[model samples]
Target: MNEHYDPGQRRLPSQDFLSEPARSIPIRYRPDVLVVGGGPAGIAAATAAARSGASVLICERNGYLGGALTMVTLGSICGLYAVSPEHITPVVRGIGAEIAERLHTYGGTSGPMRWLETASLPYDPNSFKLVADDLTAESGVELAFHCSAVAVTREDARVTGVIFEGVDGRWACMASSIIDCTGDGTVAALAGAGFEHDVPNGQAPTTMFRFGGVDVERARQISRPELHACLERAVASGLSLPRTAGGAFSNQPHSMHLNITRILRDGVPPNTLDTRELSAAEVEGRRQLRAYLQAFREFVPGYEGCFIADIGASIGVRESRRVMGDYRLTLDDVLHEGRFEDAIACSAWPVEEHGAGRGTRWVFLAPGTYYQIPLRTMLPEGIEGLLVAGRCASASHDAHASMRVAGVCFAMGEAAGVVAAQAASSGTSVRNVDFASVRADLLRRGAFLGEDRLTQPV
Candidate 1:
């Protein structure tokens, strides 16, 4: 049989042939760091890593960055700083605080400290996305949007690359070291690192929704009514609160972000999230959020014209997995104000717990005290070439509440970025990093030190 090729049939139009030129341009995006997630932590990590002269790449799933802050409109950043005699202090310096200061300049964040969250600030989500983009770009970090890291590649228990799902289907890029900033330890899970989801009884998870047309000033002047009280009034008015209906308020004039559901999932399953379960949680969570908003208008003060502005397209999960790091930070570590030469961030936000079918709890530190989060907590146990940041970092379920805040997450991410870059350049394992050098770098980047520095200036 003779096989003949038709030249006419094989010929392509210029439109098609243009891209397939004889000498095709090589599509190469080699980054020194591959930071996963686009939230505060991921941004900090990518920025720090790239700023250190390492080619860096940030992969984010959504078109917009800022993670929970942009998605859920989180109220305040926890663990940015702390003040106390045994203060433990915030050792995290560098790009993390720089971003915070910059955000403040843009009106999304308030100017620095003031007794924990006294100066809690808010900004338009779209604006934040721009700020994040400029930040990573300015640091010379390449960014990939609409990208999700679904898998991690390892060799002999060492991380080498992140397997991603993006516009180009499945592909991966090599990295000397990786930072697991995915809040749920998605990368760590793929890396075979150990973790524990909300312990004992599953903890409550929330799908954040926004309420617009709110009288923010009026609401701020006095207690417009906390979520619990608002629900209580609803009950009095014959409305019942969903078992999962609970959340902290956000900064939108009329918007309140709710953490109103406990998504039930098999922790042992290959996936931590399921569309069906997540949808159910969102539906139920929104129902409760609307009910409370109605109650606020009818029974509470300063909620007139307030209505559900938007519900998070994506669920804002609080806990799923905690990477088992070399040091397991415990509740006692927080209560004792533990400090370490490898300190990464500081916190004063108390042990907060949101029970799924039960209720909510906030355990605060003494009036002026704070705690230190050691660096060992970020090192995944038995996993070389991997660093965990954000909520997944090493911490007891309860300790996570304090460290999981956005401000703290940023510092942690930055630390991880620095560590990863250092490891890549020096040809050393993450464990071999010099803390003094890290500290020096952080300070140079303008990170506020000492717990009192976190205090609100009168």
Candidate 2:
């Protein structure tokens, strides 16, 4: 009767296995806190831990940071603000606000732009990468780029170290505490942690792309509904479009960043963990872009002269493996404004689900209200000495849709970093760390955790 039970159970394929001789991998850096993945969550976790006076090391598969913001080439930073008819107020602060301010200072963002019922900050991916580098460097967080976590070292229920394969070959890094910021829960899965991976009912992945030579004024005038209508027209004319309604933002002149083009295989979302399917998805994603370019040029008003400026290095996976943590956030929690005693972060982002259909499913929260994400959500259910943050944190599929955005990930990572640092320094299990102390630390850092009531417009 327990949902979290047998979280890792799945259908297995009958395939021959190979045995390799055991070889010892060379030990690398042993920091106080080892944060895996250099995306928004990893960046925040490493920086926060380092700032908390812990020696932190972050390993990234790509040479650059920014995760989805840079690698997937997302157009805008979502989940940072709470929306109402009269006001758009920030709900996620601390590291998230700092990153936004820094991005603006670098001329990387178009401030906050309101669209539909929400507001998001449009940013340039290159500037985002620079901002990430500056944040980690200033916090004294060491970085190891081009490293992919392949295995995890566990002492009973505790994850002690991680094995990674990089350009230099396989190496091991030990730590007092580990944070799994890899969006797909890579480290947790390898450590035999329970996780939920529902490919059949999972949100479909997208291939983000950008267009140049656009009439900015004309493009800006086209609202979401109008764009959908235009795409519908294209569809009626025998052009295939998996998703007609999606996000489009412009931070530069004569250019548009598009979050369009849903990628599916055989009418279903591809399982990204499978190498053969993942490779096929990448090729399929690019192939969809060509069709979209033609659709925009022929049907859309301002995109008649538009050409493909760039495509994301990878497909944007909205959902994958979600680790089973101490508590799984639910849809009721998001809609009913769930608060927690050990709350670490707040999110006002709506439940935005992309499925195997032309339109997405969006369920918005009440105006000017938000839900608190507790620190327990990041603590793996039966695992010690490890924290899983970002999209892969414990949550139901619906709750994950809302908290999976960049702003919430930043908040989660920041909290996890602080907790990890305390655990490592005090030689305590992450679950045993004092919640009140962690809450105070987060409050001192300017994080909004739904404790201070905001003035809502009547």
Candidate 3:
């Protein structure tokens, strides 16, 4: 009577079907300063706020903590530091620096390079997820994985907490303050904040992938003209390129994150649902990826024997909803390398554009040039007790291109955390917090808070 053998037996019902009293697990709502996201920015913000002595809670919708890092296999952390003015400006400090440092110790990243405007170091995505979780947990920040923040609860103009949707079903959690690190500006928009990005149609999109057994050097040898020629021939011969957007061709070991496939879609307003018709985009992306690889084999020298490795679990969405704050950082500021009095973080990452659906445009900062990101950018306009980090921070389309890099976002997260902690300690909104004290504390904590090449204390 093999218990497993069941010709007459039926599989258990997918749902609870037992005719008996059912037990319930109490729904837990525990986050003093709830941060909605667990990516690099969210992790940095949550960890710093926890260190600042608040019971932090991080709601990461994904099963994993590292958002883009794990999902996209974003192997490198770009823009943490830069070689500007002949001296490296290590703007991404504090928890972000600690993470980068620890990863550097593990040989996950390399030192500053001249070719790339900012210093980018490789990282292990799996290990990064573990480290982020460990840091948050160690700091006593309760994290909810597989839990998405679907809606927000607001009081007047301030955000009070969030509504979560997950396996446990819908639940609510109240918080003293909230940080929108969702990259897409989830909390901000839900709280009725204005956001904008490139209009008409957002730049082409890209689906990143990495493969093994690649001839790194040989692949690098393929010229743009050669690629264009092959692509032209392929089109003429009935092969088609993907219609998705283009992004980065990030570095990898014996492989690379091919971000060449670009798709163009309209940039919808914030709070409203973003449905730009991407259901068929991924399928077309895969088809183009396979086709392009085949083309490279036939035409390029390095791709003779290369094959696919692994596609990203989710698409690497670079640009999205940006919070409308008191001060909207714009292109003119970037052009003049403006530094501000209330600057929270500084960045030298260039204005990186991916596709030309609207036509790719790049405006590079001169050597030794950098710009400041003010605290005003984090606080949504006409909103109190809320902050934004990551790609959702206040910036014009072109400015977002420069400041939305991972390194810069990490710095922004750190800034948000410190400000949130200070405000919490003094029982005030971030806008009313003592700027002098905040700046002093950030400087004391080794965060880069400088004005005119001078670091000042309160």
Candidate 4:
């Protein structure tokens, strides 16, 4: 089956449209589970499903894996640990822990580092790509790189397959169960599933970059407050900087990965789904890097000799479309440490919101406490044979600010994979899969869904 578009039929005086003749897309390899987006979530989903005795295929739009981690050059894996003044506790385990351990072996990461009421694992983006490749390959998950999911094949309300456009043109691949790990809810949206998109009011995006020739010792000594003060000085000196306080990490000597530039246009974040606006955002993000470099050189200590080592291939979009699911995770849930009977993942990450303002808003959870994410959050409402995971999972904006990080995504993906595999193998609806069995499988796989599950027998 082929989905067709005919925008040319609508005439507009200001625009010209052309329609290409419809053609059938070739059916590619069939798999029990198809995971889209190849990011943290897709990696775990495909790996778990394949290891769970189901044939799985993961399609990534980029040439490599590690979506935002590699492509956007994210310096660290957030949401893995809960932190307080006295101790840092691991809250995300299972595939997330496994990946962290693997990164350690590859010298890709320096393990968890505590900062301003939180803890994260600092990693090298390049090494992460290799780790993702080896992890998925060893798990027997087929990989198709440079493929973008363009359309969905649906039967009633169920997603039967996805059509992807790659370098070789379009092709379709059938799957018994599908997981939308696209981060933007692209797959679910294409399948006609309802979603919420509010870019102007959503969390602002960033363009991460790296600087070389930095005085690592001096830079490391600067506290978050000091850093902000320095940037503020730069701003007062007739320089423009959208954000004063942000993250800066060094996994390599004399180099720093900076996540500081907040991309906005006309006092609001540009709609990233629009090609022109997205392109402009990318350019603006890079443009801000120069101002940042000057600010660090003139106002901040230890960056006088710093030079741009790299800029992300694209801007890091923090939020886009949050697909409506069986449950919408709320800020109250995050703050109160909400628990669910069918919990599949746990997150301690705070509600870190980036807006049009120069400073971000952070509402931290109780020290060492985390909230459980139910399986229902991944089950898109009115959709069958599909699961939505990762940043695009059903969550209120404030709640998404907590769960959208890489660690929680890994946990969510792992559960979605296992559930999808079970449903695919049994020829059952995803919602019909027994929660107890799913929880048991997740536990058996060494996942931590919360302390409440510890008393239950696996």
Candidate 5:
């Protein structure tokens, strides 16, 4: 009945099983604010909180920073500028603008380009990662990689600390405030926060791929309609094409980034948190990429001799868990350009909803206008010491469609970080902080919260 049984043993009695008594995990570090998920929102939150005189710690599961921007190889950073045919207005400022400025300084970004009606700033993913690392380090934020938040430690209504699993082992880190920026709202969900799921079908998840040896100049010569027409012809010729009107952009000489493949997770919901299904989706995405390579080589003119230079480190998941916060942003708010008294961020990106298969629909607001994202959307209802940012913020599906872009995420994160720092330093709950003071600090930092004075001239 020894517990040290043979490894090749077929069976062992339950009483003979080895077990360890529950013990307290070693505390690795204690910070005023602990930001989980090192994507755009987490980076912004950690940097801003640290700059606000709070000791901050940011944990990321990825080896590098820049969340979706770098991991998914998302081609562009959208939602920074207001959408209008007459002129473009940059509304997302503060840390978002700073990141873009850094990218521009490195010649890593392309000027504003209109896509699906809204304007987006495309940048080199490598440049974004470099800038994110520099800013996070410079802000005096402690960084840990290959670490994932697994569970929440709470006292009554407030989250006291977070338990994470990493290569070293399970450990706990205490913090006065926690920011959930895992895109999928991992931290908030673990803290018993209510959330929504897409159920039958979520917004289509795409696996971005890039092509090398492409004739970028020649590809630019063809109109989008003409290119889609070519794709239609390819589909008619028995090419297994998932989407026909998907587009690609030239990022470098002879290099093009394409966001075309659509992986339908039919049986498995996008937000199920099932590792097996996620792995299957990734495999299917790669398979689809190969099929696209064949079609590109045969049908497209510029891609005749091109080859896939890279594929995304992970698939681009559009919708996941939308945490139920104090305020749920609705479509009417976006379409009518609704303003809020406690507005923390502004977005002008239209509601770009992608369905399961081929088509995507767009709905725009009035010209030279945008809607405000209230601070309540980031404050999960009934959850203290927790703030939700990025795609997981409280919003209706349609409203999320517009505000889930990178630039908007940056704004939200900055606001959440400042709020967290204020609450942590004051030893008060996030709900008890004075929002007017937060606004004043944001304005000083160049964040455009739909304020006329802060809005940059086009």
Candidate 6:
């Protein structure tokens, strides 16, 4: 009997199928550090590694850098400055502050916008991309745009290299150390790093929109309570509004960036890895955006003659897969303003949770205080030659909300890159790198931790 033929005599198809023989993948670059995802975190990582005299390679799925900052037009660098009504010192500095200063020099950023509890620096997306490119180039890091990290090459408990797919072909690049800055924790999860998934009641995804010809002064003058009342009236008047209390900020003259659209898919958590669910979320997010435009035109004062300048390239994802690392930052740590003996970064941003409700749920830290992001948060368990940064760093859902902002990501990425480069050059594991040494390096670079700062060895 033919193997392709059924015993009952039913017609059968040919059994032969094309398969490739085993072959070696051409090594594109052998760098001291390989950073995945050229967003804020990856850019910081690559730049830091290269500046540390290590050859670095950074890849991004998109054609440009500044992942959410550019692609999603996030506009603001939250958690960069401190969060006190008085004495707003900058909690985030070093490379993060350098980037912000560049943006300000280019007239692409606004001065510190102070709120009652926290403050942030708003910047232009185009300026962010250019600044990222210039900084990364100046650091002598090799950048591969429009390439995706599809797979990994690992040897017993260690990731050796990353396989990337591009328009040209597939190639593998070797590196002594790897940093997972894919925000969604894509690379770490693929490399068998354990992660927390599908967080219950996680923050919802948001779509940011730009409006042109708006009366910026008038829009800024509208208080939060007044805006919420308008949104409530719009919903009551049968507007297809998804949320009730988002607001707009002035990005440029006569232009306002609105972050008012919320998207929630039934049976699908906001941070789901399902492609179908993500697609639906995108579509519905855009739909909600159109409705928001209509509502603003009909209900708001300054938006009567406004028009949408642009929508984000993608929906802004808030919470996602957080790799389970050496330590999981908890909500208690954030609320109590926990201080770590091995603190690598600090965040003053409150826990801003956008959930299935009319508005956001905000939990505040004590005035003029912040919590420490320990070095252990970036060291994922059961994965060697790898470190997690950005929003994917180990944190409980609420803690993630507080520390997942761009400023904290930049600090963490720089720390990861510096440590990874050191470990690579010194023939050591990332986990073996001394936290006290890391603290000294960060302090020397002008990063703010607390008064009990680490001092160099005598």
Error of 1 at 146 (Å): 1.6
User: Please, what are the lDDT tens digits per residue for candidate 1 over residues 42-144?
Assistant: 9899888988898888888888778987876555555554445433344344665566567766777543334322223344565677788888888898878
Order candidates by TM-score, high to low: 2, 4, 5, 6, 3, 1
Off by over 4 Å in 2: 1-15, 455-458
Give me the overall lDDT of model 3: 0.70
Cα lDDT computed for each candidate against the true fold: 0.68, 0.90, 0.70, 0.90, 0.86, 0.83
Give lDDT for model 5.
Answer: 0.86
| Colliding residue pairs in candidate 6 | none
Per-residue alpha-carbon lDDT of model 6 for 98-143, expressed as tens digits? 9988998888887678764777888899989999999999999988
The top-ranked prediction according to TM-score is 2
lDDT of 1 at 313: 65
TM-score, one value per model = 0.83, 0.96, 0.84, 0.95, 0.93, 0.93
How many clashes does each candidate structure show, in the order listed?
A: 8, 0, 13, 0, 0, 0
Candidates 3 and 6 compared by TM-score, better number: 6
Decide which is better by lDDT, 2 or 3: 2
Candidate 3 regions exceeding 4 Å error are 1-27, 84-89, 116-119, 197-199, 221-238, 242-253, 265-276, 451-458
Which 10 consecutive residues of model 3 have the lowest summed lDDT? 1-10
Worst 10 residues of 2 by lDDT: 1-10
lDDT of 2: 0.90
Best candidate according to lDDT:
2
Error of 6 at 164 (Å): 0.7
Residue 106, candidate 4: Cα error in Å is 1.1
Q: State the lDDT at 421 in candidate 4.
A: 96
Candidate 3 TM-score to native: 0.84
